[model samples]
Target: MSNDRVGFSQPQPEPDRQALGERLKEAREYMGLKQEDVAKVLGIPRSALSNIEAGVRKVDAIELARLAKLYQRPVAWFTGEDPEATSEVAKEVAHVARAAATLSQQDRQELARFANFLKSRAKAKATPDGR
Candidate 1:
């Protein structure tokens, strides 16, 4: 008998290992962490971290959790299941683009400067003694 039962969901596709590795690498870089430091924290060799970043090695669950904690990112982000990857973010991006398009050239330059200031301020906040 064909088991075409209701409520039987199809299996989800496997997460892309290469993409996951790329996200992990990006997070590490964003946190200003070198592979050696991250590997040392994980109690693994630097070469293993390199392999993991190159998508040549699989990260076990425990390691993934540790990496996520160190990187300050959710595991779902590395797995391409980021909660922020939603229509709301797209809408916000679109709104920003539209607003920028309407700005005069000088206003746009001022806006860009303001954005740079905000970025630098955030960086300063992240550093000890406010840079």
Candidate 2:
């Protein structure tokens, strides 16, 4: 029964729990979700979520799935398996979101309207007659 015997399987390497925890924390913050809110949605105590973010506790598959859904990100991103997840565009989006968080409600609404206007203009340009 010794593992050293031939035909025995080697032990698998452990996942990087701390790095996963950091990604989870960053995603949660980017989504503007408080730990308590996420914990409640996951049917767990806030302390448990805190421990998970602190890398003191492991996240089960179900919790990870729920978190990915809530964060609107793929599980592969959290696991550091998505190579394009940290692209420049994503970083710029994050920066915009953080800056928008500091804006007044009226200014935020204006920003949203401007974004819609830009989208409309882009669509018009893509069309043949520029409607």
Model 1: lDDT equals: 0.79
Which digits, one per residue and each the tens of the lDDT, describe model 2 over residues 1-131?
68887757533324587788889999999978899999999999999898788776889999999999998888999999998989997899889888998899999999989989999999999999989
Task: List per-prediction Cα lDDT, in the order shown.
Answer: 0.79, 0.87
Off by over 4 Å in 1: 1-15, 83-131
1-131, model 1: which lDDT tens digit per residue? Answer: 45556646433323486677787897787666799999999999998898788776789999999999997667887887776843586457546756885788899899889989999999999999998
- Please identify model 2 stretches exceeding 4 Å from their true place: 1-15, 104-131
Write down the RMSD of candidate 1 (Cα, Å). Answer: 13.1
> After superposition on all CA atoms, what RMSD does each candidate show versus the true structure?
13.1, 7.5
Per-residue error at 123 for model 1, in Å?
24
TM-scores for every predicted model = 0.54, 0.69
Clash totals, every prediction: 0, 0
